[model samples]
Target: MAWTWTYETADGRETGRSAEFETRSDAESWVGEAFGELLEQGVDQVRLFDGSDEVYGPMSLHPA
Candidate 1:
């Protein structure tokens, strides 16, 4: 199992997003330390995704 980071942005009617990461802890730390600043500046959302099948589905800190 690996952790992935994802971000979503919609600016002026255009939607864009990205995802990348090798560890869940790394992703969460980045979001808490860096992405939170982006949120203050208008980023849509920063979230973590677990690509493990043991969970049976996408698991997020926030229910998803």
Candidate 2:
């Protein structure tokens, strides 16, 4: 399975998603660790998406 990072702009109309990662855990961890920096830099929001099931964050970051 692979993982993807998605971010929606503050406007809520614009959205961008990243490429897939080798593992979901890696993806989630990367997002978790990068979120603060992104937010600090002015990112609106960050979310993790699973390529396999199309599930979003809150689940991706959950401990497995």
Candidate 3:
């Protein structure tokens, strides 16, 4: 299945999305590495999806 990441704001509004990944791990890793930039671009959270099915979501980009 094609894996992808969806970008969002703190209030659940979709802001953007990443390019399709070949694997879930690749998608997750991309997010982990790019989260800093994403935060700078006003993306507060992210969601992972396998095709149209959501795998997980709303992960905060900000540090706890």
Q: Highest lDDT: which candidate? A: 3
Candidate 1 C-alpha RMSD relative to the actual structure: 6.3
Best by TM-score: 3
Q: In model 2, how large is the Cα lDDT of residue 3?
A: 79
Total residue pair clashes for candidate 2: 0
Global CA lDDT of candidate 3, please? 0.92
Write one digit per residue (lDDT tens) for candidate 2, span 1-64: 6678776666543256666888877776777677766666556765666664656542222233
Candidate 1 residues 20-52, lDDT tens each? 557766766666666555555556654455773
At residue 35, candidate 1 shows an lDDT of 54
**lDDT of all predictions:** 0.48, 0.62, 0.92
- Worst 10-residue stretch by lDDT in candidate 2? 55-64
TM-score of 1: 0.44
Rank ordering of all candidates by TM-score, starting from the highest: 3, 2, 1
Residue 49 CA displacement from its true place in model 2, Å? 1.9
- Backbone clash count, each prediction separately: 0, 0, 0
Model 3 weakest lDDT span, ten residues long: 24-33
Whichever of 1 and 2 has more TM-score, that candidate is 2
